[model samples]
Target chain A: MADVIKTATRDAYGKALVELGGINDKVVVLDADLAAATKTGMFKKAFPERFFDSGIAEGNMMGVAAGLATTGYTVFASTFAMFAAGRAYEQVRNSIAYPNLNVKIGATHAGISVGEDGASHQCCEDIALMRAIPNMVIINPADDVEARAAVLAAAEYVGPVYMRFGRLAVPRIFDEDYKFEWGKAVVLSEGADVTICATGLMVKEAIEAKELLAAEGISAEIINVHTIKPLDKETILASAAKTGAIVTAEEHSIIGGLGSAVAEAVCESGKGVPVVRLGVNDEFGRSGPAVELLHIYGLDAQNIVAKAKQAISLK
Target chain B: MDAVIRKQLKIKACKARMGIIEGVFNAKSGHPGGSLSCADILTYLYFNHMNVDPQNPKDENRDRFVLSKGHAAPALYSVLALRGYFPVEELKTLRKSDSMLQGHPSVKYTPGVDMSTGSLGQGISAACGMALGAKLGGKSFRVFTVLGDGEIQEGQVWEAAMYASAKGLDNLVAVVDNNGLQIDGKISEVNSPYPIPEKFRAFGWNVIEIDAHSFDEIDAAFNAAAEFKGKPSVIIANSVKGKGVSFMEDQVSWHGSAPNAEQYEQAMSELQQALAELEA
Candidate 1:
């Protein structure tokens, strides 16, 4: 078998920024002294004049992005998710979202997958936070191709975009030519028994859970949700309507991420399907390997397989 | 400054102060003390310093100003109205539903508002970002921001101060309206960010101190800020809270309170008298 190709979303994000810098002179990258971690260092190397290091000040960096956007520049402010969504929530809300500025927040190192750095570094509620803010477009890409495309798409769309990325190296799920449609969900498989809605690295894990369910003679439809805010409700509700059962999976808190979004959409549409959310519960993550932490947080394929059965039974 | 220009500025400043009293009095809710305090400074910028055209408020090359101390929207609205960005009559609808002039400076709704600012400690950072944007674009547009003395208590202001200096944003100028009083009490008692000039200087800015109401001093400081190269500038403009109206001046009680009918009449009467004196 050919070796499975893998890449961290942060790597794709960094490379995509360099691409934007080359094609668009208005593209400016701002980092809060985390260019090395968030992978914006690539853009800094390619366009030194366009890159700004805000020096351990995430709030200021966000405000700077808002300011730059006012003057006709497209700014991507890159930082760890904890700082971008948690430490500077008001800045993002008041400065960027309130005015609806052309500022794209590249928040890398989200969810429990940020291992060893533990709870303080990991942000499990960024989607909930970003979603609550008006005019914020949240996108959590599933793979290398999708992540790269999402960055370019966000640059093209003139508004506030909160793009979540991860540090863990996950398997590439899409082809090199996969085009990322804005606010659209990708249907990976078809089934009748249950629908598995997953996002971020969990999408790769959901693909594995589909095989696991298949081995047990259960047909599972897999949908990859990259954009969480504008949330392709049409795709999710159609799948829910078909299967009559849904299992939402993510590497984030189940309360306000993909699971909550799917459940909300399903409930609001009167689908009456049993939606089982498989994600980190209301608890802080611990120090461990990224893979081990996901497993411990019940964000792995085995958990999704088990949850798929639960959804099927609930139906 | 020329003698004729000083007289014109004084007359406009009085009109701006009257507008502040009118807006707050009508709204029955808004910050008047701080707004009145910075009236002269704002009048100076709009009437004399800034390279902005009311006819072309959205012109790409126009100078920018962020009201970092955004509760002072009455003062800004009055200045904008006086500058012909909007009708002066629109000031009556401030803080009302459907009014474009919100209680805070909203860039989206208000014309000539360079940046949306209400959340304190964030606007100066935005101003810094605008300045940085100009430098990158190789544009000559300058960015100005006004922060309240009490507002500097926010930790984010220091973060912006640090970044503004580090970036060498020569086009950025931040003025701390050192009005002394906040809603709670005196800034010193509330939380002293005293010796404000030292802080900016420590952050590597070109620091200038001036009496906030002095047009000559205000003009000189703005000129110095523009001429200075390789660093941002911070002008600590020492000013009186509720500067024009005698009953409200230096009175912390008037910080966030709207005057009652009697007080409104008296305040407007006082400002009208001042405007008449300036004209005379």
Candidate 2:
């Protein structure tokens, strides 16, 4: 394996916001009293005038982002994923998504990786909630390189976007030269026996799971799906057609995260591939060390390997 | 305010009310009560106060307005049409399947709409954002928003209020149409956001109270808002639930119900008479 580089996606997001601020004078950042936590404080340090602290008002911050977008500004509103996507769901839907404004919602601390804060702070349903809104683009980047690139892509896009980031530092799967594409899945490896589609922090786990499967004489394809909303149906369907079996993994709930998105895509394409979803089953995340929580909730690489074997058996 | 200008504004207000009636009557559904109540305020803002051009609706320098109480879109649509944003004939297509005039204000569909608003308590926050954006961009444009009396019951409104004040958004002005009614009943009974002015004052805003139907007070309030510096302003315009038609005035039943054929005729007749008197 290439020398692993560990960094939180939120760190990349903060650095990206500062870079965007320098490049685009119209870029503005708004935070709801979580500037230091969400990492928008980096942008705040670089450009104090453009950063707006909404003072613990997530819903108002969303409306402000929508309002700023109307005036030709690319507004980045940051907060915890639980608050940005869950608490302010209606504001995001009505104010940002409904208008199709040029607002990028940079939601950090997503999924079970938001350890110690427990289920109240961890957001597993943001992707599902955001996907339901029309004109909303959902992006969940896996590593530092992808997170930074996704921020730039979201800034250039002329509509509302929801970008999810995690709290814990994870293994960097992509190098600095990696380019992020919207609505296009990046195939990490090619195999015909089965496919493992993953997103966000789970992409690293899927990579680890592929090696484990290979050791058992099973070949597995690894596809990193960064954009969940405008799902790369063509790539996903082609992979499903070739592999004829799928194991979807994520650090979110099994009900409505990347797993659900992949299953829906396969079903909609009428590809009869049996998809074994590996994620936190219908349960809330508990307070523990992030890695331990992932293991307890069955969201680790071993879980993905098990699901891949199950999918192969079903096939 | 000059008598001639007041007379013209009254005429425009009457015409705007007529458009509201035309829209709701044709659609067979809409919130006419709140729309009629804020007709005078909308007329004053578009025709007299705001520096907006119908031909250049998307001009970056133009003043922005957000109808925070978006159910009152009929009032905004009527004013925009009268201001030549689109044809007055388009008012009849409101709430239709493919019409640009949606059930709420949509910036994408409607011209002269600064921000798309329908869900209560959100528009003011966007207005704050616009005001802050103007400050950040060093633009001279100002932003204005209108909210309903009952709509202020939303917690988000207070959150936005705190933000506007904390940000010292003097370029932003919020007008609350204190019509005293919502869909259920009187605002007091539904959930009283009473003492509106004091509440805004508590939030560090320069509060201005006015009779929303009076063009003189509406004009003066806006001017006062423009003059205030270092803090946001709120104009609490006390108004009737339904102002123009006699039968509908202050009637909570008219909150979201459209006028029937007989009721529509009565409303049009009343508005036309008012317009004729103003012209005289």
Candidate 3:
């Protein structure tokens, strides 16, 4: 822990937009008056000519991003997950995804970890909402390194993409040398006792859970699912088959995030494995400290360890 | 206004109406009233205004048009065909599942369609983006988008309005097709966006008011919009809900309804007579 440096994924996203802007002059950034909060203000400062704020209108922001995509520009529309995915879902689906435009939705402050902002700002359902739209690639980066890479990958890839960034500063899991794969999962640590799959802020927790499970003599195979949509079927199914028991953890709702994606994949593959999903169960988050919310919502290491054991017992 | 140019545009506008009638009658489902209401303006843009090449539909330098009231996609498809982007015969396949022309304008499928729009209040925002895109690249291409009078009730339209001005999108031109009727009833009754010109002006736009069906007014308004600098422009085109076809004109029943065989015949005959009179 002493050796590891932690950086907020949103910080990485803002920096990545700046770095990408310099690399690709056609990359345009649009924010919905949440530039300071979403961290797109950094890009605005760097390239005043390229950044345009669409006031507080998330719907219009998305529509404008779609329009910009028609020209030779790759547009990134940034806002809170609640507004970007929840408020402007139709605009994203119709204007961007329907046209399959090159507009990247950089949604920050996702999940209950959005903390003191309470139930209104926390967006646990963004993954599900984005997944339902056709031609939309959903990426939830686990840490700062992956978040930066995800931004570049989303830009280079032509089409609409939704990337979720966390507000909390989590321990950096991967170094700067790590490669980001689209629609691919990274198997952090392999073991046969049970498969512990997690995403976003929960990915690091899964690693800690692996250590906790190791102390209890349970060898948990940890998998970091960065790209939730297009599900990386091969990686997930193979891990499920190998482990025979699975547990999924995310800072989102248990209903329709990484857990749901993994469950559907395992079920569809005809591999009858026991899966225990660890997340907020059909409830809204309240105003609390960021870390307390994770623990209370069952989004921490102890819960992942507990769920991993439960999955193994069910199998 | 040059009488010869007006006569030629009238002929094209008549052909455009006939195509719209053919498309809706064939599809058995499409918005004919709004489509017909916009035919003259659509004709004016494609035939005489927009710098677009039929052979190069995706040409980045070409001026762009986004039909914000995209239920009027029939009119756009017709104008695109009249402009030789596709065959006029394909207008019959307007809303068929296999057709490239969609229920709404799809920028991906349709050859000359600039932006995809169906959900109301989105097209104008996209138009703003196009204007911003051109300004970013220091390009000369302009963007035009058409909106329904009723569609202005959407809060997003105003958001886009203020944004276009805030960003100083001078290359953008938006037309509110104030035919006075939405699907429900007259726009005045259905949450009025009336005094549309002053609203746009308040949003820092160069506002122009015109009779949408008149070629001279349409020409003058679009030309003024083009010449205006340092701010975006909005043309409030007062129009008949259903223009050209006598029975459907000003009739709210025709708002989203496609005409039956007899109605289609009468509409086409009326447009054919108008075309003949213009030629004579």
Candidate 4:
């Protein structure tokens, strides 16, 4: 029942970045010798002159991207999220985010979907780390359609932005004509029993959980929190107010990722709603099949549905 | 050097030194040793050598400078302020919150700052990127960066060195302040950065060894850097840790320590006499 939509989010990023390059001459693409892995190959194919392969030096690549961005170039530096957020955090904080350059960091290989590569490559902490930066705008789209829109949005937007994507194929939840807007949450479904706020690949799982809850005569509201930095506080609060209960989900740490963002919003709004967060609880991921990893990490729709049910019991 | 030009350069160097001292003494917390060590070099660049506009700091074709070792923010801030990038009074607010003069250089906050750099060994890479950017954009402007000898220990600095040489970054000039002390201890004890000129030469850079305190050698090094083509050049500026102050000379503890009230008065008096002597 959950196997409805399947498309590589990386494909969306590649296609969208190429389209963005065709229009904006300042939109340059830089890769850390992971062009093929991050699917920035299409950008390289079209704009060979504008594309920069900074070898395997992630730190140097980050500084180079920031430097290029300072010279009026809207640079989209793509690599594994692990390297972009983990390997070059200092550069991102000082050279890029501190100066507020218009550099888009398109980070793929997010979550356990980077299976068989082990925990070393899968960047589950990227969201929390990037969220800590002052001027960084974090974007984690739900699926391919949203991923394409997010990529295009990041290129057009100013300042430093980190757009995280997963390597595994996920459901295409958005339409072809879907447009991406910053700081706006896409309400996939509305309900009164419980509000399920999620980001990145977890948004798709939340949508499936909605169906599972609906079969049990529960109305679960699903909100796709694409922009986690300038979070849509109004929408989140409104859902929490009406639903009286909420559950936040993400493919990141339960500490400072989308779940934490939603919790902060709920706490600030003084809603005191029963908020349940579903994510990796201070644990590293292991190599396995995608579905098995999802279940093992308790991130499947079933787990989310259970969390949502528990939140309703408190409600 | 011509009589009039030499006199003017000496005056500018004195003014730069005065600015450095004033900003550091007022803040009561800043890197005075490194700032004083690089004052002559920064003075030579900002006042007489570099083609920059105080009115237009973002002029694309203007000469660029990245203080790779950005702990010397007081010196750079004073240079920028004295050059009319902002009000000279703002120099008093160094490292204070809400002030443009942060602990490190930031282009977003300060005028005349080409790039914000605090992390050592990273700014050279950024400078290399700027050089590459200039070539790609078909701009003929040259890019210059000043690094610390102690900062060269970071492996990324060598990576940038290799990158600049491989790309034939002739438009880039790197001035290394060969002051022997870092924060912990002397450069030799901390990590020997010996044969600095030869190392750069091996990496395909035209190396120039000069007495950093001598204005003549500083001038000649810039001229030599300009003459070289198809390769980056490094001016290995031999300097004392605290170049001007007698008590602070070659002192590692003075790397970031502010002078006490009594010491501040003495330091100020010394700088004032030095300025007066240069004028005389």
Candidate 5:
């Protein structure tokens, strides 16, 4: 197995989609003219016949994807997070989600990682939008390995799914041996002080926070909740029960995001764990470098450590 | 057309309209105006035109029908129920919890529903895809979709229209239910989709215009579209918002507002007379 390092989930998604297309002839890709940015150009090059470039019409592409899904084709609709979840939300909700089609929406450029494109392109609110739609399996892989697993999982899972990936490459966190499972939380490390439940890019951040907390003698449990919907309820409940405190971190809005999903699961399970959701505080991100944006939004490991300390202090 | 079958279709259309009336009136919630307006077209499609068997709703080679203007689901539900997709008794379950007949067409719940629809301007795209699928599979099945004239304001419809034309989807025929009313007011007042036939023609479709309510015109239009080869077709059916009900006819307020008990009785009486005249 290759040494585990943090890599962008988008790259992993690109690689996995190409692999999935290799085996499954029914697998087709439709991009809204963002093949290069969305990292689906590789698939387009391989399968010219199956690849459809709808030329920047996100809504039309979404409808086309839904149309294709109805015909017994496994359709992967790719676009930027804003266009995929924001621009074509109605299409996703009605056309694909409503019918429960086998459509995989690969939404990239999520969060402030889409720097220089500014606020319009950066989709901090995508998770909220997709999570609100019923029957949509929202998965944000923590790293490249998880992203590959997510792509395979979505291919195997028979329904509409929203797989969000960030464009910026971070540290590769998972080894080649790491397996991906939908709706399951992987506990990277377990501790009794507090559970640091995180998703997407923040999983890496939480891991680092755990390392930092170790030096301070605060044993924090680090959980990578890659799947946002069908949230790993057992893992969450067990972790909450053991730790008695929780903090959810994500590169998204604190509202209706990873934190909110975690809160809902915990509330339903009747767990009274105090949770501090660490994310953007109802503000649009500014144009900056990816690391800068993460720090500015209080989504870095330092912030996670601070929140975990605060959450643990209460209990 | 056989005289007996034509008479049966007329009877079916009357029953479909009654189903729409009763379904909507009971729900106290539905698009009665558009439902009534498109009743004849749906009746013609389900009863006379398509190769769908109620016993085998999910038949692989079955003709696919998509109601793009999904607010008109009451009409579709009525037609499907009367056609034996399910019991006519289920008509009362429209929009109710655990009912297959949702506010809009739901393939998940409804037996005969091919595609779930509520969002305007999407079903056409799905229909196009089905036609493409049929072509790819070397199947001879045809796909039909109905869109409200007002619903075409959504640019996605045009996108699907262009895709269908570009693909030369001959097996696909779209019916533009040209009732001028939308939710707020007249479609012209909202966003005029004037010259709908010309618009479709310009988009590389074989265009036909007809009085949507008249079975002769609808049958002729379908036959003509079926006969044409190499290109997709669009039949722009000129329809009133509320076609048969005297008080509700041409009324924009009926777009989603259901008829009360009195109005429902009156509408039923009018449709009964029409059915009697056709029967006679």
Candidate 6:
């Protein structure tokens, strides 16, 4: 461990917005009255004139973002994942994606990690919903470094992007100098027996599982898939060819998150590599502590280790 | 406004109405009632009020227009064509496969459209964004959008309205085409957004009422919007469901129904007569 620093992805996103605002004068921020919670208030504090509070209206905020994009501004609109990806799905699709507008949707409080809010606030299917929209680039960063880099990358990319951030503060996986590339998975650890592909908060768990598996003499490769929409098929296929077994981990539902995406990629590749998925089985989250919920939903390192073992056995 | 200018606008509007009919008739499915009702407002904006060039549709300094009531794409397509954004003959390809003229206003496919809009109540929010962008950039270009009377029933519309006022977007103007009908029936019978002006006033907007069919009133309302400072303006243009065509006037059936062969001919003949009278 390199003296890991713990911070929420939302906090990194807010800091990145302030940094981007200083670098790019055309960068604008919009939040639906969740500035304090979503951490967009940092941008508001830095540039009050450029920050727009849409007053608890997520759908209208999306449309406004699209409008701003048309006028040569790179817009970052923030809200909870449940509201941004669920309530305003139509607005994002029609206004931003349909036109291929340059709007970055920075959605925080994603998955069951949004503790104490229960199912109504926690979003488990945002990846599925956002992935269905055409011209939408989905980026779910795992740590502070990747989240900050993803925000900067999204600002430069001139199209609709959905960046998922977490409410819970997790350990920093990457260092300051780590280069975040879009659509390219980063291999954190190398193994030969099985591949563990994960996204968002689960990437940290995957690393922990990698250590546990190493102790058990099971070689497991850990890959961080940040961009979920344009999945790094080449990297995943290569890993599958090398390992012949795979396990996917995510804080979302197993039905349509990282697990389904990897499964689809493997099926498309015609690789007979058996895959095990570790995530919340189709169910809503309860009002509990985020760390406890991760354990209850089977999204911890132990679960990943178990799944990797199962995948290797099947292979 | 002089009679010559008014006559020119009238002739142009009549031809645009003819284009609307031609497009819907060819598509075999489109909204004509709201299109016809909003023809004059679209005509005034494209022809007389907006400082836009068809050749430079994407010019950063050019004024932007959004048809928030996007079901009336036939009207906007007609105006954009006559304004030379594309060939007027392309109007026949409206709603056809492999054509740029989609059933709704598409900023990607359409040359002169500033924003893509089909779902109601979202266009005005986009307009507010443009206005806010202009303010942030210290640019002088203005943004205009047209909304349907029934579309105001959407909660998002009110949300955008509140934002526009709070931001002091004086460079934006929204026109509500109060044709009094939606897809179902009368707007009041369905879900009345009555006292529209008061609602806008409550949102802290500079409100104006006008007859949508009158060029002078349309011209004056836009001029007033430009002069008003520190707040966005909303023009509630009272209009007939189908203004020029007598048979379709106030008929909810024409809300989204395209005309048949005979009906198309009847509409063309009536529009041609109106054009002749304006030219005379």
Candidate 5 ranges with C-alpha deviation above 4 Å: A1-7, A267-271, B1-5
- Highest DockQ scorer: 1
Q: Note the DockQ of each predicted structure.
A: 0.90, 0.88, 0.86, 0.69, 0.59, 0.87
Candidate 3 docking band:
high
Question: Model 6, B42-99: lDDT tens per residue?
Answer: 9999999898999999899999999999999999999999999999999999999889
Shift in Å, residue B52, candidate 6: 0.3
Global Cα lDDT for candidate 5: 0.88
lDDT per residue (tens digit) for residues A1-315 in model 2: 556789999999999999999999989999999999999999999999889899989999999999898889999999999999999999999999988899999999999989898989888888878888999899999999999999999999999999999989988888799988878999999999999999999999998888998999989999999999898989988999999999988877788778888888889886679999987788888899888898899888898889898999998
Model 6 / residue A204 / CA error / Å: 1.3
TM-score of 4: 0.96
The docking quality of candidate 4, as DockQ, is 0.69
Local accuracy by lDDT, each model: 0.93, 0.92, 0.92, 0.87, 0.88, 0.93
Which residues of candidate 4, in runs, are more than 4 Å off?
A1-5
- The DockQ assigned to candidate 2 is 0.88
Model 1 regions lying over 4 Å from their true place? none
After superposition, candidate 3 runs with Cα above 4 Å error: none
lDDT tens digits, residue span A104-192, model 5: 99999999888777898889999999999999999998888778988998999999999999989877788778888768899999898
Q: In CAPRI terms, where does candidate 1 land? A: high
Using TM-score as the yardstick, the better of models 2 and 5 is 2
Tell me which residue pairs clash in candidate 4: none
Candidate 6 chain B worst ten-residue window by lDDT: B271-280
Clashes within 3 Å, all models in order: 0, 0, 0, 0, 7, 0
CAPRI-wise, candidate 5 is medium
- Docking quality level of the chain pair in candidate 2: high
B22-136, model 4: which lDDT tens digit per residue?
7777788889899889988888898878889999989988888999999998889877877789987888788888898888999878989999998998898888878878876
